[model samples]
Target: MAARTAPAQPAPAQPAPIASAVRRDTADAARWPDVARLPAAQPVRTAIARHLVGRALHRLSLLEPDGAPAGATAGPVLTLHDPQAFYLRIARHGLTGFGESYMAGEWDSNDLPGALTVLAAHADTLVPAPLRRLRPLWAAARPGQDRNTPQGARRNIHRHYDLSNDLFAAFLDPTLTYSSALFTAFPARFDSLAQAQHRKIDRLLDLARVEEGTRLLEIGTGWGELALRAAARGATVTTVTLSAEQADLARNRIRAAGLADRVEVQLRDYREVRGRYDAVVSVEMIEAVGCEYWPDYFTALRRALAPGGRIALQAITMGHQQMLNTASTHTFISKYIFPGGLIPSRRAITEHADAAGLRTTADDGYAEHYAETLRLWRQRFTTNKDAVTALGFDPVFQRMWEFYLAYCEAGFRSRYLDVRQLLLTEGTRR
Candidate 1:
C-alpha cells in the first residue's frame, strides 16, 4: 500500500528565486501540453540564446556538427545538426524556437528531460536582469479568444483534452488518472502508479470529509476516476467537464463500473453549476479557471457547497511574484498550449478561498511525486510513440507531445512546479 496522507503542514514554501518567473497552473507546468506554429529565429535572439546555452544552463552541453563551440563547457551535450538554423530558432523564437527546433530534429539531447531541468532550474537568470525590467515591452498579450469566458473556456479545454482520448490511453496508467499521483516513495515503481493515483483521490476525499450519502460535487471530471472512487465510498457524485470527449468517456466509464446510478457526469462549465453539495472537490481544475476568474471559481465552490460543507482542491502552484509577473504576459504555454489557463500561487489560492468565505484548514504538498509521475508518463509516451502515430498523430505532433512530457518532468523535478492538496471548511468549521 502507498503511504497514508501526512498531517497537514504549513503551505509549500515560495519556490527559490523566480528565475523562471513563469506562471504554472498545474502551477502552469501542470496543464496538459498545447502547441502552435511559431515564427523563425532572429539574429539578436540567437546570440542571446547562444550565451545562455553556453554559459547559463547547468549540466548542459551544446554540440555542433563541426565541433563544440570554442570555450564550451562540459555537461549534457545538446548536439546540433544545423548550427546556424538551430541557434536561430532559439534566437528568433526564444523558448518556442528551442522547442520547435527540437520537434523539427534540429537538435537532440542525450537526456531530454534532464536537459530541460537545467533550463527550468535557472530559467529566469538566463534572461539578463535588465531585460526582465523590459518584460512589458516583449511579453505577448493574452488573446481574447483564449479568455475563460464560458464559450472560450470550452474552446481552450478542447484544444488539449479533446485531442484524442486514445492518445492519452497510450501513456496513462490503467486508471487513466491524468493529474499527479501521491506515491509511497521516490522514483515510484511503474506498476504502482494506479494505486498511488487512488491514494491521491482518497486523500482528497478524506480532506473533504466525503462519506456515505455525502453529496459530492466535482468541478472537473477527469475521465471519471475520482467520481468512481467516491461512488464506491457511497457518496453521490455530480461531476462536470467542459470537454465533450471527456464527458462521453467519463459517462461510459461510470456506467461500466456499475456506479452510474451513484454518479452523474455533466457536460457543463464550473460557473454554471447548481445546488449545494456536502463536499466540493476540484483537482487541478482551478488552473484552467484563469487567474481573472479565480474569484469566480472560488465563489462557485462556496455557492455549490452546502452549509458546513468541506472542500478539497488538488492544485499545481508556483511562487506568488512569479504568478503575478507572468499572469498577463503570454509565454510559450499561453501562446501554444492552455491559452486561457494560469497557475496560482499557494497564497493566491488561500486568499481567494478566504474571500469566498471558506477557511483553510489544511495545506500540504508533494512536488517530487509529480516529477516521478511525469517520468513514468514520459517513459510510457516514449514506449507508445508508434501507437500514438497509429492514432494519426504525425511526426511533429508526436515530437510535440514528447517534448511536453519531458518539459513538465523537468519542471517538477527541479521544484519549479508543485502540486498541493488543500482542505477548506465553511463557517463554524464543523
Candidate 2:
C-alpha cells in the first residue's frame, strides 16, 4: 500500500469584513511595543485608537529626529505612526508630553499658534460616531442637580488658587494679583507685569468712574491688589474672596500698607454678601461660577449694587461660535486645575446681565493683553522653577502647572481664548 500523505495543515482563517474595517480604522493611532507584545486575545490597540479619535485632535505631524517634520497637518488630522520611542512618549503622556516631546527633538512645528487655531476650528471633526449613541445614556445617568452653591464655590477656589501662595507669588507681580489681562489705551513704557496690572487697575477705576469717598465692592478680590489700589485712590473698598488663604493674605497686605481703615477683605461667598455699594467689580471670578449659575450670579451682583451703581466685570470669554464639549476644555480645566470653572461667550454674559436688569455701558476685548500677561507669567514661572519645586511641589504637579500656563499662553496667542472687560450699570444709572 502507498504511504498516506500527511494531512494538509489547516489554512489560517481570514479576518471577517467587519474586523478588517475595525483594524483599518485604528491603523492610524500609535500603539506601544509593550501593548503590541501582549497576547493576541487581548487587543488594546483598537480601544486606544477609539478613545483618541473620539476626541479632538490637538496637533498632529510626522517628524524627523532633528525637530523637523517630514510633513505636518494643521487641522484635526489623524496621526498614524509607530514611533520608536520619543513620539510614543507624547502619546502616552498628555500635556506633559508636549514639553518633553519638543525638548527631546521628537517633534517640531513652525506655527504652534496656527496649528492650535486649526485644531480648535476643526475640533468637531474628532467626535466618533459611537459617542453620539452614548450621549443619551450619559445624560440619563448625569445628576440633575447643580453644584454651584456657596460651599461648593469655596471648595472650587481652593482647588486652584489656594494651592500655595508662594508658588503664585513667585510668578505673579509684586502685588501678587491674578485676574483678567491688563490693557493700555495706548501702549506705554511701563516695563513690568506689575505696572501692567497697575494699568489694568487704573482702567477699571476709570471705567467704573469711582469718585473719592465713594463705596466700592469687589467680588473675587484676588490678592487684594485692586482693592488696595482703589483705597489708595480715596474710594472706600470692600472685597470678598472664596479662598481663606487669599483673604488672610489680602488682609495682612492691607494692614501692612496702612489702608486697613479704608479697605476690608472678607472670606465670603459672593452670593451670601449683603449691602449696596457705589460700584461693583468682579474679575476672573465669573469663570468659576459656571454658565448654569450666570443668571444667579448676575442677580446677586445686581442685588449687591446700589441703584445707579456701576459694575465692571472682566473675564476670559469663550469664542462666540465655539461649541461646548467639542474641544472639551472644561473637562481638562476641571480635572487638573479650576474644577468648577466655565468660560462663557460674551453674548451669554451680556444676555444674563440684561435679563438681570443691568445695562451694558461698555464692552471691550483685551485678547492681546492676555497673551502678553500669560507670556510674562510663563517666563516668571520658568525662571522660578527651583523656588516652585522648593515649595514642595512634585514633578507631576510642576508639569501640570507648566502645561497649564504654557497652553494658556498658546491659547491666548492663537485667539482660541479671549479676554473681555464689560462695564455695566443698573437701569437707574444710564
Candidate 3:
C-alpha cells in the first residue's frame, strides 16, 4: 500500500447548488454595514462622519434601537430603518437631506423630543470640521419669489392660513388662535387650550397697556381672535392680515361676536398699515417677516405706535448661532409649510427693533409651554385625521402637517427654539 494512499477524500461535499445560492445570499446580507451608507463618501469624510455621529450619541447617552451603549442610562432611541439610504442622502444634501430622510420614514425615534434634545446639545459638533467649511455650498438659498413683498406676503399667508377654516378648526382650539398658548396649566387638557389661548392674548394686551379708549393696532389678524379679545377689553382695535381667507372669516367672526363696532379687520399688508395707535400687538406674526424686511416691519410698527405706547410681540425664536447659520438658507419649513417664513432670533428682534428706534423692555420665554401646546394640537389633529383627509388634504399633506407640529414640538422641547412675549417701547425708554 503506497504509504496507504490517503483514502480519496470524498470530493469535499460540494455545497448543493441551492445551498450555495442560500450561502451567497447570507453573505451578501451580512456585507451590508451595520450602519448603512457609511462608505458613500471619501474615506476621510466617512471617518469624520462616523466619528462625529458616534461621539455625539455617546455623549448624549442615547441608545440605538436594540438598546445600545451596553450599560449607559439611555436617552432617546434612534432607529435607522434604512441606514444606507439615510446616510447617502445626508452625504449628498446635508441638512435638507436629514429632513428628507425623516419625511421618507427612513429613520424614527421612540422619543422624538429626547432625540432632538440630544441633537441640540451637540449641534455645534454634528457637522464635522471638514464639512463645516462647505456649509454655504450645501445650503439652499432663499427663493427670490419667496420674499415678504406685499405680493409675496399674500401668497405665503394664503398658502397656509387659507387652506380652510374647517381644516384649522379640526386641529385648533375653538378660540381659533393659531399662535402659542400660555398654557398656565402644565400637561394641559384639550379643553384648557382655549382658556390658555385667551390667557396668552390677555397677557399681551395687558403688556401693551390696552384699556378703555386705547387705540390698538394689530399686525396679522389670525382669524380675528386677538382682535376680538382686544376689543372686548373696550379698546378700539384695527387688525390687518395678508390672508383673504383669514380676513373673511375674521370679519364674520367679529360680526358674530357683536364686536364689529369695536374691531376692524382688513386684508392689508403691514407695510401699508397707516394709522397711529396707542398700543400695538403682533402675535406670532413677525416670523413671516423675512430677515430683509424686518427693518421695514419694525419701522412701520414704530411709526404706528403713539408716544408712551408699548408693543407686545409674541415671537418664535431659535438659537442665535442657528439663526445666523440659517438666515440665508431656504429650509424645509420655509419650502413646504410657510413659503416665505423666517423665524427671527431674539438678537435679530432686538437689533431690528433698535434699528427702528425701539427698545425691548421686557422679554419672557415660554418654550416649554409651546411644546405642550404643540402636543395638544398634534393630538387633536391625529384625532381628526379622518376629517383632515375629508378636507381634500392627501396623505402626504397630512403627514407633512403632522411632521410640522412634531418638529416644532421637538424644537421647543429641546430648548433649541422658543416662543416669547416681548414688550418693546421707543428707544428713548432705554
Model 3 root mean square deviation, Cα atoms: 16.3
User: Number of clashing pairs, model 3?
Assistant: 1
* Model 3 per-residue lDDT tens digits across residues 196-239: 88888888998999988999999999988888888888999999
- Residue 381 CA error for candidate 2 (Å)? 0.8
Ranking by lDDT: 1, 3, 2
Q: Candidate 2 lDDT, tens digit per residue, 35-124?
A: 212123223433553346333343233222234354444322222332333234433433333334332333333433334445544544
Q: How many angstroms is residue 103 displaced in model 2 relative to the true structure, after the best TM-score fit?
A: 14
Q: How close is candidate 3 to the true structure, as a TM-score?
A: 0.83
Q: Order the numbered candidates by TM-score, best leading.
A: 1, 3, 2
Q: Whose lDDT is greatest here?
A: 1
Q: Tens-digit lDDT track for model 1 on 1-430? A: 2233434332222111101111211122123232223344466767876776656543234343244463364444565655666667666556766776666556666667766777788877877888778767755677878899999999999999999999889999988899999877555643388998998999899888899999999999989999999999999999999999999999999999999999999999999999999999999998888998999998999999898889999999998988988798776676656779998999899889888888888888788778778878777887777798799876666666777877877787777888888888874233
Q: Lowest lDDT 10-mer window, candidate 3? A: 13-22
Q: Of the pair 1 and 2, which is ahead by lDDT?
A: 1
